[model samples]
Target chain A: MVTPLEIIRKKRAEAVNRIVSKGYLSTIRVYVGMATCEIAAGSKEVMEVFRQAIANGLTDVYLSQKGCAGRCNLEPTVEVIEEGKIPVKYGRVTPEKAREIVERHLKKGEVITEWAI
Target chain B: MEDVQYKMMLCDGVSCIHNQSKELQSAIESELDKSGIRDAVSIHLSGCLGMCNKGPILIVNPGYTIYGGVGSEDVPEIVQSHLVEGKPVARLVIEEDHLYNRFFRIFGDVDFFGKQMRITLRNCGVIDPENIDDYLSVRGYEALAKVLCDMTPEQVVAEVKKSGLRGRGGAGFPTGLKWGFTAAQKADEKYVICNADEGDPGAFMDRSAIEGDPHTVIEGIIIGGYAVGATKGIVYIRAEYPLAIKRLEKAIEDAREHGFLGKDILGTDFSFDVEIRLGAGAFVCGEETALIHSIEGARGMPRPRPPYPSVSGLFGKPTLINNVETWANIPVIILDGGEWLSSIGTETSKGTKVFALAGKVHNTGLVEVPMGTTLREIVYDIGGGIPNGKKFKAVQTGGPSGGCLPEEYLDTQIDYESLAKAGSIMGSGGMIVIDEESCMVSLARFFIEFTQDESCGKCTPCREGTKRMLEILTRIVEGKGKAGDIEKLERLGSMIKKSSLCGLGQSAPNPVLSTIKNFREEYEEHIEQKKCRAGQCVALLSYVVNDECVGCGACKRICPTGAIEGTRKEKHLILDEKCIRCGQCYDVCKFEAINKV
Candidate 1:
């Protein structure tokens, strides 16, 4: 019989594997800077923009909120990471740009150079 | 159609809530519904991002764009423009320097976080604190598992001791040694208490730690319990921190469900459980003895030490008490080993310290730096210097119990020994940067007043001494002080420091004493010349109409007291007797006519 300790060890292993595998499986990832400062600076609207885009059938893209990267003045930051590609960080993202990023960048596989910080 | 392609994590920290982040969340939900994409995206709540000033933060995945300062009014535009049209809003994007590129480079090379080394705050702001899975994925509870499975109790204590970890709760006591003392005690029941009663004015390090990553603190506490052979743990936190309390409560519940906190954890016989005890917001209760008293359902008053809490404490049993920050350091020590931590900080003090950077600094937020990092680096490089181009006057450290250091002391490395040698205790890390506009004499008086009011009055020296010092400082600020008032204050301050029963009274006069030592001339000017150069003391200020005044009659018209008497387009003259010294005329003077002397 497996003891409680062994059960927990197994659970931990399973969690690590699940998280690591998820990171690898996703073809493209979108990260929003969702720190308190970023929220105060209007990142929520940006998130909604992305949500709507995804609902419009944006596929193969996994989106999540990450913690503050400490660049507070340029908050509401956004970054797009594609597998085997350099991640692109976009600062001061608004709702309108969120749609453009989804259509122009995520769909066409192009970085929004003018807006990327 | 397919799985949700976008996930947005919204900050649920107290600061964000205060900024109406919940309203923002609902607004986003409604907007998503309007755009008909509610099913394609998901929104999850996360912890603090450390940028409290800019709250209600949101991050979107797959092209990580962090939008800050979001409001409800801006929601529809975001959905219509970005989500529907496939174009991001240009006006709302937070434009930052292109120096930083990584999304989760919390320890990145940016100016605000460049100098910071986040060890105690490792997972803070990064993980969804309420979710145990997020914490577990980041190597949480693994240290506890390692301690319970591989290392014996003695070995655990030895590793902590070897790490050279000291208490982060003001006093730099060895944490491992304290555990050793408790382990040696002969008792059927032993207790370990996490002292979360962080009472320092402007200090929120403990609150943020618990709010951002409660599991880390919980994990540290459990490891501590295993090391000291304690089966019971209590978190004595202040009731003022409702969000922190709620998060900690949830974290405890989650940890228990996951079998990390309950009996026979990880299939070992070392069963440990933790309970939460709320403090009624007493500053003195931060003292270990007083904290234990409060936890025992008694009045929160500190008793004299001899039989320290490690020997006999909490209902006549050996108890181990560590501060919130101290306990938060445990898992890192266990996971990284003592030698690894020992290599980071100064020669004596190992690892990093978290400071609540407030006051005149441009970036007034939480910053953690390795021990021995200079005050200049903290105040300038990391804090972005004093705001509005104001001259850096001084930085106050250690809160009310700590002292204010002058610009000359900027090079002094921040460590236990150096801070104490500078006549300031390394308090629970409340660093307030002072600008040139603030008068040191008034600042000293403000701190002394707080201590005098909070003085438990249990001891005579702290009670009577702080009251008298405050009175003298008050008199000095009001321009009623005599020649010998400063000296009298010094004598009383030192006496109180020596005779106080607890840490409160002993360190109560620290602000006054340190200000006197560094800015003695400010006090001398206040007493002798009856002049406050910073013009902070209203009673000592006298407004005069100077030649620079252009008879604009703006000052005369705007002066509530009608103290200024002048014609249009001419220099104004202030009636000194009628002037209440409100500085209204000075502010209204367009031609720089009003002079404050």
Candidate 2:
């Protein structure tokens, strides 16, 4: 039986050999806004829904968080990005709605027109 | 290199957190499973995205669509329609006229973001803080790289000096002059400090910066260290801000790994590192001298300044200290020439200011307005013009250390010099909007109460004088104020402001002074008429069941001492002696009964 640590080390070595770029990582990014304005308007839960969705599936998405956009009053903001698109910005998504985003928007390319601005 | 694919992001700041965001995570997971395309989509939770008045935010990447005021129930609909169909969520979209979109509608067109330049907050909400690559993509450490690879220490200091950029952490000291003072000294291990211990009662500009763009501060510090030829830097943040601390720690690790920090950063001779020191939540630590003392493993108390921090700072060496916001600005100033940076704002005050615009405003949140924006624009256009259509009475700037600008001063340009001219100091950019329902006397007393408690017993003027001022304020709020107390407050305030040991004590009297300057009539009414005009001060209030009472038992049930004696559906009578005047009963009453006059 192989030890998990050794296996992880071996896999890491393999990953390094396979690495195309130095000190590089394949990143899938998720951004949650938790500024004071967002809190008052309740964006915390909206971010959490996505977190749970990702944690359950165990996808390799890198999480980056931030503060208010100076818009204040409208909160529970999240932005997702890949290598392009200059950041896909979104605002005011709720928890249950977060599930819809994951299922329909994330899993499928179809975005809920009612929710998308 | 492969182009970026797809993403789904959500808001998870205070506004979203309160709305049970925890449950939404599971829902998203389960929903994605049903679609069998979860592999293609990635979901992430992030901090506040602002414009929280309409919240529970979400943004879908690749198409750049925003949905506002969302709920858990709307999840399936979004997935089935927009997510599956690739359509816009129009119903949830905030369709404001041509502006910065739904995200910054309240602030973008308003003076809060329009009048302000965005040097310090350039990448705040636009970029992701956790990803070094995102920061890199946005030219994050390019400034640091430039400083290390090209400019000499003298050149760096000279450029900064040419910009005429002053410290945003009060006292308005030029950044270049301070850097020069530190650079002139020959210390083997000089230090660069970012004073992130923002202890102002309602001020959270520093907190927002750290939480929003942690790398900017890191880049700023690295640049500052490179400019001053310092090998080390320290960020003194308060323990109360866990999010900021967490992000900053991550930023440090990332910078070190990315060759922006640690030994031979970017394979250059320049080597700099940063550490986080959490202050024990003392308001006085906002003062530079006290902050240095705190960083030196001592109690945060200000010592009289003769040998300033620039000469003999942390650990008995020349140190350069600037606030988080000030540090946040360095990268932009360095990247964009000093001339471009100097062009914005007034001659004295350059760059945009980030303000925690709170209280009585419709779109209350963190705002980055230009230096020369008027109070009217920030309050009206950006703030959504006060909740429930209330008239704007005043907007208080500078936190406890600032003065309240009255309605007459609405059009006054908000720069350090202009604010000071209007009897307020730009103290850390805590702009609190006050409406008609707010009592000036109580407001003044509230700030005095905060200052009195947070005062370190280092200086007699701040310690004893604040206590005296608090007492006098308490009296006025209780409607027990004497005629002569106003004169005494003025005299004492002048003395405290003029004679205090440091910035804390000197500016501690600002709330009292500014409120008095603007609303002296409120104090006079409290003294002469023995009334609390806003009906806030309980001591001056007397509960009486008025004719408008429809026999609602809310007041009776809510009264702490059973002060109200009434049957169901009958007018109540307050037993005044039994009433502790908690005012809970007054707020609970739905009818026009329970008069507090």
Candidate 2: clashing residue pairs, number: 75
Alpha-carbon shift of residue A38 in model 2 (angstroms): 5.4
Please name the candidate that would achieve the greatest TM-score relative to the true structure.
1
What TM value does the first chain of each candidate achieve? 0.83, 0.64
Candidate number of the best lDDT: 1
- Model 1 per-residue lDDT tens digits across residues B553-584: 77777888878777787776878788888887
Tens digit of per-residue lDDT, candidate 2, span B1-597:
112233556665455667756566667767777877577566655434443456677766655566777778877777667667767667886642211232332121223343333557766676556656656655556677667656888998888887778888876788889989988998787899999988887788888788778988888888889888789999999998887898889989987876678887776667789999999899889888889988888888888887998888888888999988888878777777676566656668776677888999877777776566678877876676888877788889888888898999999987888889999988888889998899988888888888889888888998999999999988888778998988899999999999999888898899888888889998898999998778778788887778988887888887878788888887778899899988888788877776777
TM-score of chain A of 1: 0.83
The DockQ score of candidate 1 comes to 0.10
Question: Which docking class does model 1 fall in?
Answer: incorrect
Question: After superposition, which runs of candidate 1 have C-alpha atoms over 4 Å from their true positions?
Answer: A1-9, A16-117, B1-109
